[model samples]
Target: MREIFEAELQQLGDGLVDMSRLVESAIGRAGTALLEADHQLAQDVIASDHEIDRLERELDERCVHLLAQQAPVATDLRIVITALRISATLERMGDLARHVAEVARGRYPGQAVAPAARDTFVRMHDAAVHVAGRTTELLQTRDVHLAAEVEKDDDALDALHQETFAAMLAPGWTGTPQETIDVTLLGRYYERFGDHAVSVARRITFLVTGDFDSEHAPSHRAEV
Candidate 1:
């Protein structure tokens, strides 16, 4: 029974890792498509919803099977439950990425961002990709301390998001009304990606402690 359980757990872990990678890829591509106004890339992202949904269903079924067959107790149960939550988080992240892609397509035939403020949006997208990648790695390692760093990383994303807002309100940027909206919305998608990564980190923390802080915001040590 022990061996069987371990094998199932390993399978679950692998599935989670695979899902995280797919989600990260989708997000990164979507961000790039938006910034570059690559219509085909944007369509690819929109088409990826089916893949994300399939993974979510597979992960959910696997988690359920583990719960029923393995009868996981204590930490094992925690691990399984966290995996379930992670599946949902990754699914949501994929959805946000799709939203970014949709915005890109909608803004076709026009600039996606203001010329002067493009650099800031690009930085925000890059930061979001980095945050998603790190948090996914943290999940695989079950590194609670590292997970905690996510909130601060999200804080950085928030700064970039604010810059988008600031630029939109600036007279120069608002001149391109459509581009201004797309930039603001794209910033929102990136911010939400960071927020979702933070949620995954919190889920990991909960799995370990079986306890949660009221605020549960990322701590100084979490950044590590």
Candidate 2:
């Protein structure tokens, strides 16, 4: 029974890695779709979100089964609970990617970001994609150092997010109302994407070191 339980735990970890990979791909493609305004690619990203949601449900069900049957204690219990949280975070990350794709799809045949904001969006995209990729690697390897790198990437994303807002509010800004809205939403999507990625990283850190700081807790909602 102990061996079987251990195997189930391993399976849970594998499930998280799988979810991370899907999220990485989703964000990468979503960024491309946003930058190039590729309708088909955007549609593909939106459609693939269902699979991420499905995986989250399946993982949560398995977690519940383990809790009911195995009655995990101490570290094992923590692992199961953390897995549930990470799965939810990955699902949200996937949703953020889909949101980016949705914006691209909504503005099909025309670029989503205006010319003045395109460069900032491009930087945001690159940082988001990098964070997503690092998140996948962090889950796969459980390297605590990788978690620090993820935090750094999140910082870059935050800076770019601020840059987007500054550009939009500048005196010489000339973007139409629609363009301004699109850019605002797009910046938020990428910024939130980075936040979710950081959440995942911090969770992994807690799992590894058995330490958590409430002050630095993950942000799930947008800051006003």
Candidate 3:
């Protein structure tokens, strides 16, 4: 019974890693679709959201089964609960990626971002990708160094988001109202993506320290 329980736990970890990969790919491809104006790529990203959803459901069910059958205690219970929270965070990240893709699709042949703000968006996209990638690594390794790196990556995204808004407010800006709105929404989407990654990093911190007082504790709580 213990052996079977351990196997389920391992499988749950693998599922989370897979889910992280899907989110990373979604953000990267969605950014490409937005920047390059690729309608087909945008459509592909939009359609792939369902897979992320499916994985989240599967992982959640596995956690439930483990809790019901094994009745994990102490650190084991913490692990299972954290897995549920992490899965939910990954799922939300996937949704943000899909939202970015939707912006690209909405613009169709035309690019969602205006030429002037393209560089800013590129920086934001790169930071988002880096954070997501680091988040995946942190989940697998539980390395505090990676967790710190994720926080740094999120800082970069925040800075880039501010710059994005600053550029829009500049007197030299010439983009239409529609383009301005697109830039605003896209900036928010990318920023929110980084925020979700940061949340996962915090969960890992909670896992390591078992400190519920951490800033992320409120969001990471599980009924069990």
Q: Number of clashing residue pairs in every model?
A: 3, 0, 0
By lDDT, the best candidate is 2
Q: Which pairs of residues collide in candidate 3? A: none
What TM-score, computed on C-alpha atoms, does each candidate reach?
A: 0.88, 0.96, 0.93
Error of 2 at 151 (Å): 0.3
lDDT of 1 by residue, 3-25 (tens): 99889888877887787887888
Q: How well is each residue in 1-224 modelled by candidate 3, as lDDT tens digits?
A: 88998899889989999999999999999999999999999999999999999999999999999999999998999999999999999999999999999999999888889888999998888898899899889888878679789878888888888898899999989999999999999988888888788788988888887866663455321111
C-alpha positional error of residue 132 in candidate 3 after TM-score superposition, expressed in Å: 1.2
User: Pairing residues by index, what is the TM-score of model 3?
Assistant: 0.93
Best first by lDDT, ranked: 2, 3, 1
By TM-score, who's the top model here? Answer: 2
Ranking by TM-score: 2, 3, 1
